[model samples]
Each structure stands twice: as structure tokens, then as C-alpha cells.
Target: MASKLAHPLLHALRAGGPAFGAWLTLPGALSARTAAAASPHLAWLVVDCEHGMTALHPGAGESIAAVAALGPRAPSTIVRIPATGACADGSAGWQIKYALDQGARGVLVPMVSTGAQAKSVVAAARFPPQGVRGFGSPFTQHAWGADVTPGEYLAHANDAVLVLVQIETRDGVANLDEILAVDGLDGVFIGPYDLSLALGLPPPSPDPHPEAETVIQTILAKAHAAGKKWSVPLRLSFRSLPRPNPVTNCRDLLHRGTQAAKRAKEGFDMVNVTSDSGAMSDGIAR
Candidate 1:
């Protein structure tokens, strides 16, 4: 097998330490650049095309470039494509290909409820004979942060790109074991809010409800047992708060940061600090 290219996010996960990241929801490079420069501790930046303003075509690619251009300190860019699964027509496969071709180091697929769905995600993100992804993007090398030729990129991309699936539904929770059993799936990201809704409970509480907490714990345990990285989105409230209150602003930032740290200490492999919209809104308000 050709040596897979180095990816900072994967390296951090393999290093046995928690990898922190930010979520990008706004559709521009400025927010991405600013958020990526906020803390060198960031290992990845998830461009949220699923629920955010970013689109797969040009928006995701632009934001990815902005984040990846931060040089060595740049966190690996992962595009969360706005699709649920690989439909019969193979729409998910094409979306995954576009995101990868645009230079995303990884792909975050949401609403994966079965092992079969995960298998499709993995296949879409990787190259053959391990997958069905077609190669031919001339600009892909730049997103990878390498200077290799197209052939070199293709030779190792199967292993180089990370494929993460979201476990956010009751069906997903029930099929957790099977999903984790899928080969080539690098990690699982838990969508707490969606998971809560899926469980027929009130939306995300200030703290997760007992039922949600139980589900979260189960997912974390199973992921660790399977030797796969698990991540959670930790939304910060600073953006939602009324600004002009320096003390309150500081307190909120500190509180959110602490919560993220606590999650990491509790064994989450990755934690999202904040999103582009959150940071930008907070910055503008300040």
C-alpha cells in the first residue's frame, strides 16, 4: 500500500489525545480563516453544509481553501455534505466526490442509521478497489496540503481521507454496533440535538436530559470499544447572548470552553468548540 499522506486531524486522533475543532456555518472564507486562527489547538474544521449556509459546489470549496491555507497550524478541513444516505440513484456518492475533489480532508455524513449506509459512505469517500469513487479532479492536491502528482494522490487517498458518520437517531442508536462494524469508517459524530428529538424528548436542554445522556454514554462506550473515534458538537452560547457586557461575554466564553474541555476529559476523541456563525456573530456584537 502506498503511504497515506499526513493529515493533522487523523494524526491527533492517533496520538491518543483529544482533537478540538470548530464548525463553519457561514458561507465565506473570512469566517473560516478567523475561526481557524482563533486557536492553534484546532485539529479540524467542519464546514456545515448540512444545516448551514455552505453549499457543496463553491461555498464549501472556498471555505475549505481559507481554512487549509493557514499553513502548518491549519486544521484539517472536513465538509459535512448535505445528504442523508446514498440513494438508489447514488446521489450521495457524487456529493462525496465533489467535497473530496474540492480538497476536504474528510467527509462527515449525517443521519447514518445502518451498517449498509455506513458502507456506502465509506465507499463514496474512498478510491477503488476498496471503493467506487472516481478520480480526476486536477485541483485536489491543493486541498490535501501535498505537492504530489495526481497519480500519487490517487494511490493513497483511500486511506488518506477520513470518513465520519453521524449517529443521531433512534434507529442509529439501535444499530450502533452494526454501523461501527463497517470497514473504513474512521469515526462517528454524535448529534445531541437530533438524537434528543429522535428519542421523542424535548430538544437539547441546557444540559442533556437523562435519556439523552444515557444514549450519549452508550454511543461513547461502543465507539471506544470498537476503537473508533467519537465526536460531539458543543455549541457555545456567546453568540446568542446580548453583547456589550464584557463580564458576561468573558464568562460565557470561559464556560463554553470549560464544557468542551470537560467533554474531552470524559473521553470524547473530538469536540467542536464553536461554529463560524457563532464566532462571527459574537465578534461583530463585541
Candidate 2:
């Protein structure tokens, strides 16, 4: 039997296929309309606090709250917390835990610079022996249901939680091997804009400088060797709207998929939707 796209992108990465996707911001407070917009494409949605989307409020970030609100609507939720003192203090990490407790499948730590940061992020995603995330559901994450069990949730989470570390700096690229060597990391998401800036190039440069690009490919190769996903974030933010194009959302992968298919005619796996945010209906942005 043909294997189904379980955990969609995760399954693709594990099967040595292209793992490409994009981001979505949890706008201020979430509404069902916002949830509906982001429920469509891509294997997962990265609820931004780090970059991509601008912050809508102060105190707690928008990503966590948005996930808490719309998680059930989306197939998989990945919250991106700021990589500042907030996350470094571990408070933001707990917010990530709370988002999971609310139903997020994973967390995306942005501007990840070292293996230590990766370790901390992984630790926060897990419960006890694996790490130290507290258990509290039966809330919106569990839909306030009586049927969800703590024990069951914990056990499943131990194996199912995915941690994606953002790689977007000169140092991050330089230490790519050691960072990928971190035991609990499930994957790395290349943050193209910051990476371009770090390499002393323009902010929106899609074609990475040869050496920098080589570093990125190396990370993907290493991640594949390590049995981990290499998630590339394809956000077409600067472009004007009418704002929904499948090609723009998964740019690099679209190109690679085309070339790969031409070279070998091998098939590729895909998630149910293309990109998970900005879905509109009745001639309005959702």
C-alpha cells in the first residue's frame, strides 16, 4: 500500500522528499474568520512572534493566543516565539507549552544561534523525563472536554512533538553541523531574509550568496542524514496583494520539485492544503 502523508511534511522529510512551507501571523486576537483563513494550505503554520509578521500587541505575543483560539481548525500548529529575553527567560517557552496544551503540535524557535538554544527549546516542548512542560488541558486546546486524558496526551506528545529551530544568521550557518547534531531537534527552518542580511546582502535576496547557499544545502543534507526535516520558510511578504499564490508560498520547493520530476519523474508528497493562511471567501480577506 502507498504510505499516506501522515504528519504531512514530517512524512515527506522522513521519506527524503522536499519539505517546503510558509508562515502565518496570529493577528492580535483571533477570530473564526482568521482561523478559517489559515486552515487551508501548507503542512503546518508557523504562528509568528519572531519575524514574518509584525507584533500586534505587547505583554504576551499574538502567536500563542492565536493558536489557543484556532488550533482545532488547523491541522498542525507551530508557534514562533521571539528569540529575545522573553524566550531566553523561558517564560515565552512556557507560552509555547501552553499553546501545545491548547492544541499546537509543535513550536518554532526563531533566530536559533546555538545547540544550547535548540536543547532548551526541545526541553520546553516535552514533559518531565524528556523535559519539563506542565500538563493542563481540557481547556480550549482540549476543547474543555472531559474525554482527554493527561497520561495519554503526555505519552503521545513525547513522540509526536516537533521542534523546528530557525537558522538565519552567519553564526547559525557556521555552526549548522553542531546545531543539527543536537539530539532532540526535529528540524531546521531556514529564515531567508535574516540570512541574507547576515551575509551582507540585501534583505529580500532569494538567491543566497553561493557560499551561504552552500551552507544552507549542507544543513539540508545533514538534516536528511540525521533523519530530520529541513523546513524552508517561503514567505512572499513584500509583494502586493491579491495576495494568494501557491508558487510564491513554496518557491524553492516548487522549483526543486519541477527539476526533480523532470530528472527522474519521481513523485512528491503534499499536504491537503497549499498554504495555511490568508484564505478568503465572498470577495473578502478572511
Candidate 3:
């Protein structure tokens, strides 16, 4: 399938407003419920390709395929590529290129701690002199058709690919200025869990740690000041269902959303909800 070319991330950037999104770490790739969680109104989709163990060895092709299938069906597809030396072995670059060429709207490089690391991520996602990324479109480029040209492919590949960096360690936050200064960095995503480890503190509610939130707000403020977009992950557990099997989990989420809406109707304003999974769920109001 010659995937549609509009990048949701670009739209998000253009909107220049707070963007809410979710992370999928459950078994299997993006399930129907996971995909359903994505709202076009939301800015992006961070497919936790690295830390989220939905797949033992996350395959770039499969990840791209799954996300692409949701195009126009969901928000932008931002695959969180492994941010380790293992990916530095050319295989990771291939994965980045394949995902992009296969219609992934963007790539999120996780655990980035330095300017060089951020640049390396850019290199993996781009092609030629600009970066070292390889090229292939497969079905995504043409949306499964064969009309897409090399020129068009290269242009779309360059113009629309979103590059995100995850700042998870204290080192990354301390060196935030240099990392954000790196050209072509699309955004700085915060990983609260690892960040806590970096801060020598327990995980969320990362409250009571004004220092950590300060660092996060600093990153966010700097990113905004630098004219960069910011993306955050939200994790939600619905109350409708007590247990979180795939089926009940979704129902519970809907039930909770419904209740929240009902509360709003009753004149109580409830904008966000926090749940387990330790991942950030934006608690998107349906």
C-alpha cells in the first residue's frame, strides 16, 4: 500500500499546542484496543519499540506494518528505536530506514544522553550526505501501489520523517542544552521511570521530588523556547473492568471515560487520569 504521505507529527508541530499520546507495552504489537486509543486529535503515537516488550526482538518491518495499518485510522506513528550500541551495528539504521520507508511518520531514539547520540539517531533516520539511512518503500510508500517515484520517495522521506529523542538519564537532563541544540532534533521525550533511577529516587508519583519535575519542566520549557515540540506518554487503567486482560482493559477504559464525561456533565471538570503500567497515558477524553 502506498501509504498516505501526511505526517501527523508535522501537523502536531504546526498546531503548536499541548499534544497527548499513549505508549503500548502489552503483549503482541498494537492490538485493536491500542490502535483505538490513538485519536487524530492527539499529536502522535510512540510505539515503544525498545523498552516495551510487546515483542521479544522488535522487528522494524512488523512494527511499521502494524502502525501503517492504522494510518488515518490513528495518529502519527513514532517508533521508539533501540537506543543502544546493538542498533549502532548497522542493523538499527536499517530498522530506522525501513520503518520510515515503510510509512512510519517518525522515529523516537530512546535513552539519548549526548549530542552525538542525538546526531546518531538523525543519521539512522536519514539518507545520503544528510544522514546514513538506507532506503526502501515497500508497500507503505505507494500505499501498496507502484506509482511512487524515487524523487517523490526521497522528498517525502526527507520532508516528513519525525525524529524524537528520549531524555531518560540525569546525564541527559544535565546535558539537555547541548542535546536540544543539536540541529534536526524533532523533540525531547521524557522517560520518568528511568529518570527517577537517574535522580536516585523512587518512581512515580514522581511527586515530592520537586527537583525531578523541575528538570522535566526545564526540558519542556527549553524545548518550547527553542521552537521544538514536546511529547509525553500516558498510561491509563480503566475502572469499569477490575482485571486488565486485553478485553476488559479496553472496556474499563471506555467505561471510565464515559463516567468522566458524565461527571463533566454534572459540572465537575476532570481532564486527566493517572493509572498504573508506570507508563504515561494521556487519559484522552473520547
Per-candidate count of clashing residue pairs (backbone under 3 Å): 0, 7, 14
Deviation (Å) of 243 in candidate 2: 13
lDDT tens per residue, model 2, 1-286:
1122124445544566553344554354453235435434444555565654534233123443443344333334466666542244465566566556655557777777777777777888888888877876654224212344555555567666688788888778877877888888887877766787788865433345676666656776777787666665544342423554455535533543444343222222221122233332212321
User: What lDDT tens digits, residue by residue, belong to model 3 across residues 116-198?
Assistant: 77777788877777788766544556521245566666766765777878788877888888888877777787776678678
Candidate order, lDDT descending: 1, 3, 2
In model 3, the worst 10-residue window by lDDT is 267-276
- For each candidate, give its TM-score against the true structure: 0.91, 0.69, 0.72
Instruction: List per-prediction Cα lDDT, in the order shown.
Output: 0.83, 0.55, 0.58
Stretches of candidate 3 exceeding 4 Å from the true structure: 1-4, 27-34, 37-40, 56-60, 70-73, 85-92, 143-150, 206-208, 235-286
| Best-performing candidate as measured by TM-score | 1
Where does model 2 exceed 4 Å of error? 1-20, 26-41, 52-74, 85-92, 140-147, 237-286
Evaluated at residue 21, the lDDT of candidate 3 is 51
- Note the residue pairs that clash in candidate 2: 38-276, 41-273, 41-274, 41-275, 42-274, 42-275, 102-141
Candidate 1: segments with Cα more than 4 A from true spot: 1-6, 85-89, 237-250, 284-286
lDDT of 3: 0.58
